[model samples]
Target: MRSRPELHGTNGAVSSTHWLASAAGAAAFDRGGNAFDAAATAAFVIQVVEPHLNGPAGDTPIMVYDAAAEEVKVVCGQGPMPSAATVGAFRERGLAEVPASGLLPACVPGAFGAWLRVVGRYGRLPIADVLAPAIRYAEDGYPLLPNASRMISALAPLFRDEWTESGATYLNGGRAPKPGARVRNPILARTFQRILDEAKARTSNREAQAEAAIDIFYEGFVAEAIDDFMATAKPLDSTGSRNAGLLTGADMAAWRPVVEDPVVVGYRGLLVHKPGPWSQGPVFLQQLALLEGFDLKEFGFGSADHLHTVVECAKLAFADREAWYGDPNHADVPIAALLDPEYSAARRALISGAPSSILRPGSPGGRVPWVPSFAPSSTATDGPDWLAELGEGIPAIMRLTASTGDTTCISATDREGNMVVATPSGGWLKSSPVVPGLGFPLGTRGQMALLAEGHNNVLAPGKRPRTTLSPTLVCTDDGRPYLAFGTPGGDQQDQWTLNFFLNHVDFGMSPQQAIEAATFHSEHVPTSFSPRQSFPLGVSVEDGIPETAIAELRRRGHQVRVTPAMSLGKVCATGARSDGGVFAAASPRGEQAYGVAR
Candidate 1:
């Protein structure tokens, strides 16, 4: 049974990982804004409410379906490495890989710029109007989430002892705030207010105001603050040592988010749109390609055969992601050949009843696949992760980052068939020290890059890291915008969201039912974050799954572990219903995600 009612409306619908964020989107819709405006509003609110999962200095890959243009485009807000970020630098530090935390792995923050572009290009609202709710939440205070409080409490010592600015921002008078307690970040509020003031003072045009806000953030005050912080702050990193960040004010000024065509693939009369090889987005399309050959409906939903087949297929696709996906501007990713029917068909032939113990990346188009040979998995970060006690993070759900933080998701749609899904992640309080006076941390996204030469994702200046932030857009076979959906949980994002999508498509379940249904995923591929790790044969099953199915999976040589019911993903979705209504759904897992429509 669904924990909440299905959200349906002909006017507008929005879904996000946090209730307040979703409410903000609903408010935006009420303010006579379009889906793009509502989504941008919610994305900023998510940065404030889900601070542990994302920050202003983080990254988000936005998938947008514009009704007027009748086109689907991806505004990639993922920042590239600083000009100084090179493999030789890590080698000089005597490190084989990038550290999980601290300034050394910092990248030009792309989220703020991305949202600015949204407000300028697609949204009807001004930048100040779109940012109002988040500024209010930060200034007047919003209730602290249980998970956020737990993360703060766990890192209290590290914050107080070392990351003083973070302590000042997160801790209440040197004490961790209890969960659900009202919390405020005046510094962040002031920073945002300053940007607004500067923008309004300089421009009267809405789009020009958005551009001015971008200048305040990237080429102006925000970048200066980040530069001052990174220049002197050598905080503890995953290497268990202090290191300064390579990101500079110039790097911040040099980067801008891009709006480009999406990587498209067809599956069962639906056209799935994902970001390019710079992210793990294509991994989802690849999985669909492989599964297209299987008659999942014939095996029945949630059946033993169904679970085994999907899990095995996930392993094959994700392996390809690790080997091939990277910044297209800097790397020669054979994405076209990888997603081709013949290539996927050949890869699908490898999956059998017995699980494969090896991480197998296919050679697409006869090009040799390069899988990095790394040591066993390690979570050697600067801080203690309460993840085991909290039952979250990489080992449990597939680690998306090397640090203790995960990610967040937001999706929005309206009566006009406009849709948007933004997966914002990185720059966690646990990953890097907050910049003084800014109340946010620079993202450590560069850690996802390999230091080894010859690999496409190897550490390089101006290259975007191959992030696991994958948001999805689905369209009808004829190209009408259908759904915008995504989730958190790092490497598990695609896995869990795919399960939810399949639940709706193959099982004939409603959006809410699909979200409420038990979810599962495989961690059989190498992790994308720092301290890259892999579990070659492990398949996590939610408790609600059938006992017979679990037994069958185990008997098939799958290392199946029964996780807490609904512990897997925090997926949110907004879609156009056949009845011409906008429908939305959110995962009730952890009581975090929410959906609203009217």
Candidate 2:
């Protein structure tokens, strides 16, 4: 596939999953707003426009590069479990796992709070100024992109469940809006206006203004509305029965985002920085370690040797992830052991001369000496046949891949050389309405937890959910920030990110070439769904790859399946050149994705 030309450029660039969001950010940069300001604007617009993938209610994990300090810091924009939530509480209710809905899983929305924090610390413009574009878009409808329309149309059924406000807004007359249709969110617009007003009032104190705006939803008008709605509708608790101590005004008030260390790995000549353990960022490092001895370029990009080796490494890394990766505060994960080079090399040695190896149900390394079992037995026994069909059929071909919707990523760079890469997410569209005036939803990330006994990612109170969102950044050998990239696929995220990075770093491909190239996913590990052992170990490739390459891969023991040229990872990339010009690109596979620079 040919690389798409840069969309816009000045000294910096912005790339996001949606065109309007990117344009909004680009406009900020054009108006003399720094990257932080531009990114904040983009983030707000995405919440309003790309509600399915992300919203005000979601968690955002960010990696920011400060050119001035020559240092990188990670901000964990994830909400903690509600103070009222506890494992014993779940057990008493006969709920084997934290339900994806209801009060227990409703953490305070973190993205907005984080946005406020980032803007306060680094942004050049006031929050209100940064948020103007998003406000306008919400008040006045933006043109529907084909991708957003398709997403809405396809996921309409999922939104129909009465738990989310999304069904009310995106589904017109209880049906998904068609592509190219005019879509507006007046409620969100009003909400944005309020935030802008609050922001303007506290121009000198950005954090105070941000918090003031955030509080209205959790403690003010929005909270009362939510309490009232829950009182009348009396939605089922986490177990589909009444009496799950749903979120209260207090729970909303207590929410806050945390700043944490980036998961750093020394790979080749670059220092890779990704958000910490809650996400699968470390898995990329582990894969790099496993491939240390093998020359990836020797196998050639996209060849069977390259794909098979990388997939095997990925499987091993995920096995480690499933066994020991979790919120470090709650779980006794062997973080050091997992990242140990000696351990990684040993695991890599297990991949022998075979197209696919039988996957064993075990941890990557030995069992943690101090960790206790944390598993649940709840099963989704009451879903429609299609979900079951997907559960049954897809698993048979691939295991351990999370197929949930509701995630997106952004990679941005400023003229000053500062870069911000982030993955903001919530699980499948949640219906629990916050106060109507407040346009945020409580997180349903708990759905990502496993119900099986002895699983590493079993649900627990105050524990971060096992997330698929991994935003990453790479710095070149000469101290130049080279690339910022990430994607939005559950388990497929790491797989897609690895391929895209290799395309650019190892093969010298442009950002667009890396993104537009046909991609494949290998699922030989346990996924987030049940019947975890049924999937096949194979590669699903898009049409753009040459037939001969596919044939070669198949000949070398790959289970190859040809699929449409789909965007495997709503992947976006921003590359900074030594010459100081910034190049950005978004996956053409996504209808709403675009690159805008200025």
Candidate 3:
């Protein structure tokens, strides 16, 4: 549990899920690369070593702070659903949701697209140089770190279908590899080599190399292979098999990452930049607003009062998420209204005198600024008697399973004062093959929706799923960048980030203390899945909080349960002081996470 060596230079630092990736990126910064170069390098390396979480086949959402321009830019590396992918298409085929396999799961891979966009816009080094570390790791092999080995072993049993490529990768050799085992992804190596060669041939024009590499995946050999594989895949339900018909060669070839205006909200003196309603970023702001009126210090740290206030705020925010949040192109998300101080004040006024046995359903309040041209589908369903009974008895499923797992995050800063924070992932491995050589599975993120008619997140043509992934940046009142950080853990990410921010900003805790502090999550938060949804709302904090606090919560009518330590979240952070020195910290909860500053 000892901390790794702190990398410090007068210049910069990089922090991410794995130490190897962080070091590689820090080296890039030391080699005269900008923050974009460092971040792009780290991103490629993360795909190689942390394949279970992210890879070339995943999506990436990025925020770049350019010191020169003195402006922040956001890139939505999220791939879009194929134009042909419609709710009617799923129903006509008698499917409840988009099957994990074949075309339905396919989307334009956006990670590489985002990397290229950032480097082209902000980097000084060539793409080949930025990607060299990942190329070498993929070819030469790296040790299986503790966290990676644990995740692979834990998830191996779930890969029961022997025909899938993902099953072959994890379940092959008769058993999952243990930590410290040497693992090589030559296929991934070859892909990186190709990218490197293409970049070199482009005469160091990083953007050209990126475009060519993207072509190789979407319009070249990769596209042909995916299409061919889908043609012979198994049927999703009793009717017909899914295929790459929707994600034709043309879709991938035409796909490009988009740069959108970030939805910024001022908190105190700092500005929090979050992606649009396509993600749960606004939820964080809403939670922060709800807590503004409360004296958190009065609860004394991890007391019952602290946990109750946090959980109640989370529930209210989540309720609004269900009722109002969605892709702005398809639904009207009340962004401005949700962040209004007055609106938060009204919501805060609803807390009852006594701790309730169940969460109080919240209202969206006032009118949304932008309304959708067409009404979106709903996910509700008329269940059988047994299912109805289960829903009432166990609301935790709504709380726990609201989002799918599988994502990676990176935080980087360079000597010139540039910074970038990004999260790239979608859990397609649960549904598709680990394209041989790609080292990971394409995201079936579209499956986060329900097959039930009229669901808010139903798989509609050209619609994006509501993602739990959020990459964040904070700036000081004087407009200097202060922190860049993010995490991977689905719904737990927001809760963890909120905790860390409160620790650092409110309690004046250092990076290590903020990340290392014990934390609790609201079992009341809604999840993307069914069954346990909202059932655990009244559950109280067991561990983390002091024992006295637990007893007090019990006296206040909470149903508390004790459990072992969990991966509360895997968060990585890099902070800069007015003196220009950088401090980086990674969550000790993850065996792979580390920080490198130079």
- TM-scores of all predicted structures: 0.96, 0.87, 0.86
Which 10 residues in a row give candidate 1 its minimum summed lDDT?
389-398
- Candidate 2 residue-wise lDDT, 295-411, digit = tens: 887778777677777777877777677666777777776677777888877787788646555553234457642233334434345764323322231122112222223467778
Q: Candidate 3, residues 339-452: lDDT per residue as tens digits? A: 888988998987753455444434456443221122222222353221221122112222243322356789988767788999877533333456654556666556454444
Give the Å error, residue 546, model 1. 0.7
The true-versus-predicted C-alpha distance at residue 283 of model 3, in Å, is: 0.5
Residue pairs of candidate 1 with colliding backbone atoms: 103-245, 394-399
Please list the residue runs of candidate 3 whose C-alpha ends up more than 4 Å from where it truly belongs after superposition. Answer: 1-9, 99-103, 146-161, 167-174, 235-246, 353-405, 427-429, 436-439, 450-456, 529-532, 536-542
The candidate with the higher TM-score, 2 or 3, is 2
Best first by lDDT, ranked: 1, 2, 3
lDDT of each: 0.85, 0.67, 0.67
Which is the winner by lDDT between candidate 1 and candidate 2?
1
Residues 397-443, model 1: lDDT tens digits: 22332222278889999998989999998876766889998989888
Better of 1 and 2 by TM-score: 1
Candidates 1 and 3: which is better by lDDT? 1
